[model samples]
Target: MQENKKTIYSWALYDWANSAYATTVIAGFFPLFFKSYYSADVAATTSTAHLGFASSISSLVIVLIAPLLGSIADVYSLKKRYLFLFSYLGILMSAMLSLVGAGEWQAALFIYILGNIGFMGSNIFYDGLLQSVSTKKSVDFVSGLGFSLGYLGGGVLFSINVWMFQDFEFFGFEDQATAIKASFISVALWWALFSIPLLLFVKEDKSTHISTTTKLKDGYLRLKKTFSKIRQLRHLSLFLVAYWLYIDGVDTIIRMAVDYGMALGFDSSNLILALLLVQFVGFPATLLFTKISEIMGTKGAIYLAIAIYLFIIMWAATMMEVWEFYMLAIMIALVQGGIQSLSRSYYSRMIPEGYSAEFFGFYNFIGKFAAIFGPLLIALVALVSQNSRVSIASISILFIIGAILLYFVDEKKGEKELKDALT
Candidate 1:
């Protein structure tokens, strides 16, 4: 089957749109804005703690319900509906950040938590749409294109925001706070405006026998059936376990690398520069990985990524020079998008027909829950050793475990199982 260019563009544009939140709010401005505006009266530690708590709340909410939502959406042909609801909710909540007043740390946390939920929950259905939008042969390339474009789109807006904040007066804003607030609105607009393409062009396929009864009763039974499918499908269980371990290591590195750099006496400027470098370099690097997957096979390419991460973590643990830090950043840029995009596409290929949304819910659940553990491991290791390097190096164990397990996942067998399940 030939790919639909319009649908592909629309799907890719959604990544370009929502990535502003990932870049600007999640990674860049929100922390500083929260500290400066909301916690001016309290200690910096208190504000930072609040941010972490809010983030945890968001993840917890999604982990508990993502599978249920995904299952229900699949049974009722509601992928686009759920996507619209969550995306708009996220957009509204993101824009509402502009309304938070100074000295309102509690309110800021509330809004941030809701906004994050809206953002993360929507991805369940978005990832599930992989089956609807592309073919098995093209999956890796399409998935890589989305991530590659995401890196480029997010980097551009983030850079613009940085420049705008640095020169508030030139942008006709009187103060930094006001300028930051306006940028929040910009993210909302950017996400909303670009999302129109997906909403208008792409559509979900609901060819399986759907429940004609009430959605509630249907959803419950559908979810139960999904649970049974997992029990019967050994390959899926194996893949999920493998993904949970490896992605934890991958995500932990992304979250901790900059902070670890800070711990090692690098300036904030150098750290931010590294973040930008990852986003930009990821554009081309993701495409390169797509080709690599085509030539070496998906599993082979993924194994390559795991091996590189093993080296990167060990290198970071022992590094001493500023130049070496840049090298570590470049290494991350090379493999970060590849690992995630490939993981998603690989999972899509293995899921039973018409169960993409429900199954992906479990996928997202493992991912979100595992995220909690990775950070905690680093924290525990740091407390015990009093050395950030020890904490960073300890994460490599997760990749090693994941890679070992990944070696056992037979994709050919998994595909056959999905086909039999559907028949």
Candidate 2:
């Protein structure tokens, strides 16, 4: 039991490890730095387009390859190795960001895109390890533990980084630019240092080694098999569809919130503060949300979260005050980690053992694709109505439809259906 406890803590530490990238780089400093420092010569809109394209391209690459990689990892028992490789790639790229020169937006974008790929791609295998680390009874708590840790970990480093950027002189930095670049190196080191515990302690299910060529061939074959099998997995397929829709709303809110705040004319520093609020609030809230899940059941907890998000979206449409934005951020923090962690654990219940990686490949694929539509939906709405509020509120439809579909996703039915279909 103690060994299992150690393994679980080790596994969860990766979330703590990589989340600094999410907070400091993806959500915090990079965009501001890109606009002011890297692409100072270009028009603001032009730099925005470049950053958007880089994000889309990196996401597209992950969407295309996640499933195949999962299949290969499953067949070859390579989840840990793959996780290490991608994490190393991310860590290296993050550190390299410090080396890019001013007015070199192209090089900065290239490195940032690679870093995004590394951070996002490694999650596929890290998620695959979920099943190996915890039993069914403990999965929800365990999953929530990871996200809670992520919030705390990401928030801690980001707070320090923010201080460094805001007061570069205190840190003996030459300037804020130097401070921001130094933060990148800090994220890389934090990611690398925390990742060591997982590599050293956590283990995956063992399988026999085979030639690389044969492994590749078998991987493709396995992926093909999963494709045919997935169609017949009625309830599981239904859950994935529901997850795709609702998570679309969730992810869109997460990715676009700061932009939405700017559109409402709030100060950038206030937006940053709101983000910090989410991180700190999310830490304890996720654990509380997990407890709520235990009482309400996973699906029930998810439904409650969806209901809250729907309300948040509606509130956002009419909210005109910076304080209102902060309130919305707090509300989102309460449910965000809970929903994500629960969805991951809930999906784990329906997939067969030994095939966790490939199935989670599809899981990650669906998740990555979820980010695309809500953004498009917002852009389309904004284009038609010329109102950011209307664009933001339009996301409610995704959650409404997702909740309706989720009503029919019976976990027992999914497992039974998968079993019969496989036989």
Candidate 3:
């Protein structure tokens, strides 16, 4: 029992550790820094296009690799090692961002890709740890706890960086760009420092004891078999497809919202504060959703989240005042982490534990693929309409469509199938 508690805490700490990178580098400062510093010599639209393309390309690579790596980890029992490897990769790449300066678009793109590879790749293995760490009854709460801690940690570091950016001269930085670059250094330090507890305490599952050569062969075969089995599990397959669509929209929103704010004439300070609000808001809101799930069940909680997202997208589309953005931020705070945490738990509950990693690979695969459509769609709409607001508003259709499909999924039936697989 003590070991279990230690494992749970370690898993949660990893979430806290990596979220600094997600919040500061991915969501907060990097996009602004990329546009302002790297694209100072380029047109605004061109810069936006470049950033969008860079993200799309990196996501494309992750989509291709995640499932296979997931399958391999499941077969080989190397999930922990892989997690550490990718974590270091991401941390090092993020730290290197301190080197980016004016007229460094190509260099920025290069490091961003490496950093994202580390981010996305590490998550595949991190998620694979879920089944090994907790039982079915506790999974949702623990998952929510991890996400909540992540938000808290990321928010704290981001708040510090916000202060640093506000007072750049004290650091002897010439401008906000240099100070913002320093924020990347903080992200690296915070992530590395916080990850230590998890690395020390969490033990990898050793149940899968296949020989190395056999493991490699079996992993490939298993990948092929999963494709066929996925077809047989029609409800699970459909849910994944539906999740892929809506989650893409959610991810796109989180990734692009700050950039959209910048484009919409929101002051940098306001944008940073709003993002910080999301971080803080996500911490408790995620736990609330987990409790709500106990009464309403996972599917119901997801439906609630989808409803909230629909409202947010529409609100964003029509928002005329800066205060409206704050309202939208509150709405996101209410749903974002909860939705993601529930989604992971829901899917885990449906899969057999032995194959959790492989199924999660498919989960990661669908998630990465889902990321492609919303951003591409946003870019396409922005290019055609020359309006970021319209592009932003266009994302609402994903949630609406996803919700409609989710209504057809019978959770009772899914539960029965999962039980049968275990027995």
Candidate closest to the true structure, highest TM-score: 3
lDDT of 1 by residue, 274-324 (tens): 777878898899989998988888888899999999999999999998889
Counted clashes in each candidate structure: 0, 0, 0
Q: Distance from true position, residue 276, model 2, in Å?
A: 1.2
* Per-residue lDDT over 1-423 for candidate 3, one digit per residue giving the tens place of the 0 to 100 score: 123888898888889999999999988898888877877787665666677777777788888877777788877777887888988999999989999778889999899988988988888888888887888888898889899999999999999899889988887888888888889988888888988887787776564766778766777787887776677765787788889988988999888888888778888788888899999988999999998988898989999999989888888987877888888998998999989999999888887766777788889889988877777887777777888888898888888888888888775677676555445
The C-alpha stretches of model 2 lying farther than 4 A from their native spots are 1-3, 40-50, 205-207, 376-387
Task: Arrange candidates by lDDT, descending.
Answer: 2, 3, 1
Report each candidate's C-alpha RMSD, comma-separated, in the order given. 3.0, 2.1, 2.0
Please provide TM-scores, in order, for all candidate models, with all chains considered together.
Answer: 0.90, 0.94, 0.95
Regions of model 3 farther than 4 Å from truth: 1-3, 206-215, 415-423
Kindly indicate the candidate among 2 and 3 with the higher TM-score: 3
Q: What's model 1's overall lDDT?
A: 0.81
Error of 1 at 20 (Å): 1.0
- In candidate 1 the C-alpha lDDT for residue 159 amounts to 76
Cα error, candidate 2, residue 150 (Å): 0.6
Off by over 4 Å in 1: 32-51, 101-103, 205-213, 256-265, 319-322, 379-387, 421-423
> Judged by lDDT against the true structure, how good is candidate 2?
0.87
**How does residue 406 of candidate 2 score in lDDT?**
96
